[model samples]
Target: MKQMTTIGWREWASLPDWGIVIRAKADTGAKSSAIDCSSIEELAGDRVRFTLRLSLKSNETLTLETPIAMRKHVRSSTGHGHDRIFVETTLELGGAEKKILVSLTCRKRMNHRMLLGREALAGSFLVDSSVDHWATPRVKKALK
Candidate 1:
């Protein structure tokens, strides 16, 4: 049997490829995960380049270029549909690394920079919403 790790409603995660640590919300209600990005430009051969703003106050940003996994039309909680660019990347969470599909969207208004959805959590995690940072120690070690 696979040992599923327990995570909280919110947790810290690292995107090693982008060299950034971000706070992510484990939302079981969402079907697909999303990442906050700005100035997304589609390149040739189904590739995209974008700048990820780590902090809203800081001027620092990480630029990344990756092939598009797919373009998905996601409906929001407000029943609004949006076409988002999807990309596959390595997500380091709870000392476990998995390649997951992430959609790039403007999330300035959201509390967390990243949202870990059902697809990313399937067969891997069991959420304990009452707790927070269940994997902080492990995640910190993985980041170092």
Candidate 2:
């Protein structure tokens, strides 16, 4: 078995077939991972749909609409949390990739839209708080 490795602040990731580059924050404090999304729309059944966009200061914005495979109750940052739709997908970081379950939430307000929590980082990475953005930074979407 490959021993899990540690990662710093920023890391490289792709949505597998989505062909989108996403930067995630390595946060052990969180239980589950979270991603930035917009145009959230609830579909029939437990599935939810939304657009994943790349937000960077320099590049033009790139957006893609995707749907959640499942939804479940998840604890929020606040002591009191509720059930939220969770999306299951592979998260690629630092040339390492793993299947991760992320909760669907609006992270537009945060500097880093994506956050990799313990559930996703467990046995995969060791976090170093002293350093920032150990992985190469990805340029934002190129405007057409």
Candidate 3:
């Protein structure tokens, strides 16, 4: 059996298409991974559209329009939480890449910007609450 590598409680992550990098809190308390999003809409066919507003530890802002390949209703941290829409995307960390299923939601009230939940970190990263960004190096967006 293959062994999974571990990660710290917090790390710097990049949303490539969004042109932003944000400090992500690895929350084992959270069941599903979530990203801060706004202007969500259901497009024709199997696509979902939304604008991703990002903030890094540096407090830089970047807005991106992303077309989601899939969307599904998912449960949340609280009991019987809002039905969120999931998007299939690649999360690159610690020089390792994996395709992760992330749920999109309006996180206007949240502080950290992005939350990497248990499901997303499972079997891939082991979190140490005492540390921050010990695994993945901060990656910036590609200029297109």
Candidate 4:
């Protein structure tokens, strides 16, 4: 088997498209990844604009419009289905970078600002659920 980078249940990753680092929860159970955003607006030409919330405790946010990859019907843990807008962007994590499709959602109640699911973890990472940050450097003040 190929060597895979081990990451903790929570780790810091970068979304260069928005110029900020995100704290992501590595959820192997979730098939698709999601990001916390608000004020979602769909523009002409298949693009979506929204405010990317950096943290639930802070007021930090970035309003951006990125090209839409596709929209998918997602079922929450409560068994309710909702259509989510997916945007393709560059994700930097564990010393590797790739363009990934991330769905925009309201994750204010969730512990982490971003949820890194199995689709984004496949072939790239192995989650060590017992640790908080086993790999990757903690990024600070990406905006400053």
Q: Candidate 3's residue-wise lDDT over 22-73, tens digit each?
A: 6678899887788877777777665677766565333344444445645556
lDDT score at residue 68, model 2, on the 0-100 scale: 70
Task: Give each model a TM-score.
Answer: 0.91, 0.78, 0.77, 0.92
**Deviation from native of the Cα of residue 113 in model 3, angstroms:** 1.6
Q: Residues 31-138, candidate 1: write the lDDT tens digits.
A: 999988999999999999998767656656788999999998999868999999999988888878888999999888888778999999999888999988887643
Scanning candidate 3 in windows of ten residues, the lowest lDDT window is: 56-65
Clash totals in order: 0, 2, 2, 0
Candidate 4 regions exceeding 4 Å error are 137-144
Residue pairs that clash (backbone atoms under 3 angstroms), model 3: 6-126, 7-126
lDDT of 4 by residue, 1-144 (tens): 867888998888888877888888899999899998999999999998999888776798889987889989999877899999999888888877777789999998888889998999898888999998778666665321
Candidate ranking under TM-score, highest first, comes to 4, 1, 2, 3
Q: Which window of 10 residues has the lowest lDDT sum in candidate 1?
A: 135-144
Candidate 4 C-alpha error for residue 90, in Å: 1.5
lDDT of 3 at 90: 73
Q: Candidate 2, residues 1-144: lDDT per residue as tens digits?
A: 776655676666666865666777787878888877677778766567676646644333435444676667777666767666677888776677888888777776777767888899887777777766564454545211
